[model samples]
Target: MVRATLGESSTSASVLCRSDKINWQARNKPTIYPKNFDLTDAERIGHPKQTNNGIYFGIRMGTVYGRLADIHNATFEYLRPQGGAEEPWRIGDFRGYNQAARITPIASELSTEIQCQAEQAFACRIVHNTNNNGGINLDEILTFMRQSGMDTFSLANAYPCLMLTRKGGTTHAVRALKCWDTRDVTPLYHNGAWHERYYIGMERGTLGDAAQLLPTTNGSWPLTVSVFLAGVLAGDHFDLHNWCLTNDGNPAWVLPQAIGLYDACGKSATYTVFDDSPSGGNESIWRVYVASLTQISTGIRFVINSNRNTSSTTYQLFVDVAGCGSNSKTFTMPQYSSTNLDFTWNELRMGPPAPAAGSTYNIRMQIHSMSGTSATTLWWEGQKTITIQ
Candidate 1:
C-alpha cells in the first residue's frame, strides 16, 4: 500500500524532496507559506472565506471596490441625468411640442366688418340756454358743423342775440359762442338758399317728378343753396332714371328760366351755368337738348343757376303740329316778327309718355331770316312750347 505525505509551511512534498527543503503539516492538512502561497481571508474575501494574513488582500480588494463604486456612480448619473452639463435635460423647451403633435396650430383667418348700430349716439352734441325758452342757437349749430368737419364755415352773423359754438382749438371740444338769445327768434323756414327748404308737391310723371330743392339753413329765406336729387344719396353709386341737380336763383328776384325735357336721361340734357355778374347779368343758362332720341329711353337735366331756385323740368311727351309722325319738317317764310306756330289737339298727335329703349324722337326746326342785309343773322332765343304726354 502506497501513501502520500502532505506538506506544512506550504511546501509541497514533491518540491521538498527535489529541493531537500523542510515541510510541515497541521493534523495531516497541507500548510502554505505566507510568501509563496496565500490562504483566503474572510475580512478580505467578505466573511465566507476566513483566514489569517488578510490585511494586504483586504487593502487590495478595498481599492478595487472603491474604483467600482466610482464607475457605478458615474454610469448611473450618465444614464439618468439630473441637470448639470454631464446630465443635460430639456424640460419646458420640448414640452410645448407635445401639444403641437396633437393638432396643427395653423388655420385660416375669417374676415369681419364693423357696423354702427342705430341707437349709437351721433357725433353731434347739443347745448342751449336753459334760462331762455328753447330758441335757435347759433353757437350750437356752429359747434355741430365744426365737429362734423366744417371748420372753415361761418354761421349767419346777422342773428346777433345768438349763441353759436364751433369746434376749435387743440382739443376741439364743442364750445359756446357767448351770444345771448334774449329775444324770441323765428327761423326763416323758406326762400331757397344754401341750406334752405321749399315745400312743393307735383305729379310723379310731371316736371315735378324730378326736382332738387336747395339746402335749408335756419329753414328760411332764399340764400345760396346747392341742391341734388336722386334715388341715391351723395357719393352713392348712380342709379337709373333718377338724379337731378339744380340751384336756387340769386337775390336778383328773377324767376329761373323753366326747363323742359324730352327723355328721362335725354341726350340734349340742359345744364344752366350762372355768371357771377355784378348785376346778376344773365342767369347763365345751359340746356342739353336731345338732338336725337335714338338708343335712349330717358333724358336728364342738371341746372345750377342759383341756390334759391332748386327746380327741374321734365317732358313726358313731344308732339309736332303735323298731326303725324314725320322725321323732318321745313318751311319757307316771308317775314319774321315773333312767328306764332301753334299745334291744336286735332293738328298734333303725341306718342307714349315713356318711350321704349332705342326709340328715336327726331325734331326738325326751320326758321327764316327776313331782315335782308347781305344775309343778316337772326338770333332765336325764346321759350318754345311743345305738347307732351
Candidate 2:
C-alpha cells in the first residue's frame, strides 16, 4: 500500500510518498499562481460558473459576481477587444441593472404594434412615410388630424381652452372658436411668431351677436356676455350694430346712419321777424318756431341770431319751452346795426322734465322790447333743438 501526506505551508506543498519499505519526502511542490488573463483565456479555463446564486468569474484576485447576488456593490474592469485599453465599470454605472430598461429605436426598428400602443397612450395620430427619406412633417400630421374629425378650430369651440404640444416641442394654444384663412396664401407673422394661413376664431360675444339677446327656452341662462381685447393697439376702431326688438318679438337691425339725430340744427326750425315799434311795448312781437323735440336726458340747446338795434334799447328773450322750467334772459341791443348778437345757453340746474322715448315736446323763443323811446326796429332769428346720443 502507498501513503501520501501533504504539508501545511501556503507557498509550498510537501507530499510524503511511502510504499512498503521505500519512504520519500517530495518538498517544494510547485503551487499554481493566479495572473491577469484576457477574457479569451478566462473563458478557455471554464470561468463564469454559477455559484452561490450568482454568476461568478475566477480572476487573479478573487471571484467576481454579476446580478444573481450582491450585484449592487460589484465593480469590474473590462478590456477593449481591439483598442487594447481597460475601462473600469461598476454596477452603479448601469444604475444597478444588468440591462437598460429603455433604448432609443431607429425608424426601421419601430414596429406596428408599438406604434399603435403609443398612439393609444398619447391620444395622438401619427403620419409617416416609409418610402420617403424625409423626416416627419408636422403640417401633414395636422392635416391628417383635421381630416379625421379632430379639427383644431372646432376643438376650441368645444373645449373653450386647450393646449396641444407637438412631437418637436412646438406648442399651440386655442384662442378662438372660428378659424379663417388669410387672404395672402402665405402664413402670417404676428407678435414675432410665424403662424399658418389661418386666423383663430374670436371668443363669442366679443364682436356682438343678436342671438345673445334672445331668451333661453330652458335651463339657466347667461345674462351677460363679456368682451375681451387681447393685445389691441390704439386707434383700432370696431363697428357695432344696434339690435332692437320688433313688434313680433323678433330682432331688427338699425343701421348707424338710419338713427334719427336731435342735434342743435337737427330737427330744428328757424323763424325771422322784424319789429318796428315805439318803446315801452311789453308785448312780444315775434314768436320763434318751436323745433320738433324728442326725449332728452340733458337740457336742450338753442342758437339765437339777433341784429344790434339802436343804442339804449333793451331786448328781453324768454325761453318758454315745455319740459323746461320757466327761465328768462335780457340783453341790450348793440349800437351798430351790422353787428349781430349770438346767444347760447345750457341749463344744468332745474333738470329737464323726463320724457318717454319717442315722445315730442315744444320749445319756443319770444322777444319783447323792455324800453326804447325812439322808433327802433329789431331783426331776430332763433333755433332750438337737443342732442341725441
Candidate 3:
C-alpha cells in the first residue's frame, strides 16, 4: 500500500530518495507477535478460546530500492506459519491483483445463494403488489416479510429510495435493488429507521449499508404491466437512450433502460443519446445523442437486462445506428430476455461512425416484442455523465 504519487509539476529532486546510496538503519521499535495459536482440550474446556476476538494478520508497507551488489546469486526463502494445519481445508492462499484484487481464507462462509434467495423473495413481493395494484401496500409487505422470518431487508439508498415521496406520506420504508438479471427497480416505503432488524435477513440488504438506492416508483404501480429496462455502466452513469417495455403491469417508469458510457468508477462519462419517444406510440423511434468527446475507460461495460417483464411473452434486443441515417449498421442483440441478461460491448464500436478518442456518438435500440405492442414504460438515454475515476 505504498503510494508513489508523481505530479505534473514535480521534478526529479522532489523524490524522497537521493543517489541510490546504501544505508541500513534500525530505530528503537517495539517487537510485535502473532496472535493466532492452537487450542488444546484443557484450554477449550476450562478457559475456552474466545472466538469473538477471531484471528488476525499483519500488513507491512515499504519501498524496495535497487542494491549495488547481488546477494549470493538468488537465494530462496521458505516461510511458513506456526500452529496451523497444513491441509488446504484448514488453511489456503488466495490472491488477486489489479482490478480484481481479493483474498479470502476458507474460514469465510459464503451466503450468496442464501442472500439471493432472500432478494428473490423480496422481488416477488413487489411483483405481487404490482399485479394486484395497491392491494399489497408497503406496510403489509414489511409486516408480512418480518413475520415470515426475515431479519432485515436491504433497500436502494439513491434518489428513488426515498420511499416517503412515493407512498404519498405512507409510514414505511422500501426501495429497489438494480439487478444485473432484472430491471433497475424502485420500491416504496416511509418513516423507517436505519438499524439492524431480525425476523428477516434485512440486516444484509440495508441501503447504503447493503447496496445503492434508486428513484421512486411510478404511477399506480401496476403489477401486470410493462417492464422498464435501465442500462448503466458501473456506479451511477444511467443510460438515457433506448428503453424496452414488457407486460409486467408495473408503472411505466419503474425500470428505465438507459444508454451511456462510463469510466472506472461506474459514473457516466459519455453522453448517452436516448430515443425519447413516447412509450407504446406506433412508428415512433428514438436515438441517443453523443454530444462531445468523452474519455471512457478502456474496458467500458455495457449491461443490458430485462426489467419487470412478468408476462409470459418473449422479449429480445436490437441495436441500430440512428444518428447517421435509418439504415446504417443495424445489429440486434442476442436473445437476452431469459429472466435477466447482461451484455457488454465496446463503446467505441457502438459509438457514432468515425469516432475518435474522447469523442461522442448516438446509438439507438429496439427491444423487440414477440407479439403486438405490449406497453412501454421507461425510456432514457445519455442523461447523466459518468465521472472518470
The top-ranked prediction according to lDDT is: 2
Q: Give lDDT tens digits, candidate 1, residues 1-389.
A: 00122123433333322221211111111122222222332211221222221112111111111111121111100011123332233221111111111100001111111011100000110121211122223234334434544332333211111101111111101111111111111122112322111111112222242212211122221211111111111223211122222212211111111001110111111111111122454212212121211122233111111111223221112223243442212222211111123333222233344433453333333222234322223211111222232
Query: How many Å off is the CA of 100 in candidate 2?
Result: 99
User: What TM-score would each prediction reach against the true structure?
Assistant: 0.15, 0.18, 0.22
Tens-digit per-residue lDDT, 1-389, candidate 2: 11222222222111211111111111111112122232331232122222221211221111212211111112322111111122121111111111112110001111111010001000111112222222222233224334544323211111111111122221111121111122111212333444321211111232234233222233232221111111111112211211111222222321111101010101112232222222675221212111122333454434232212123456665555466445655666543222232222245223334444454444455555565543233323333443333
Give the per-residue lDDT digits (tens) of candidate 3, residues 1-389.
Answer: 10122122323321211111101111111111222233222221111122221111111111111210110111211112222232111111101112121211001111111111111111111121222211212233334333444313322121121111112221222222333223333222222522111011122243332222112222131111111112221222222221111111322232221111111111122223331233774211222121122333442323432222133444344343334332212123333232222222343244333344454444454343444434232122233233323
Sort order, TM-score high to low? 3, 2, 1
Overall lDDT per candidate, in order of appearance: 0.20, 0.24, 0.23
Give the per-residue Cα lDDT of candidate 2 at 66: 20
Task: Identify the leading candidate in terms of TM-score.
Answer: 3
Alpha-carbon runs more than 4 Å astray in model 1: 1-190, 195-342, 348-361, 367-388
> Which residue pairs in candidate 2 have backbone atoms (N, alpha carbon, C) closer than 3 angstroms, thus clashing?
176-201, 178-201
- lDDT: worst 10-residue window of model 2: 113-122
Residue 71 displacement in candidate 1 (angstroms): 99
Which has the better TM-score: candidate 2, or candidate 3? 3
Candidate 3 vs. true structure, TM-score: 0.22
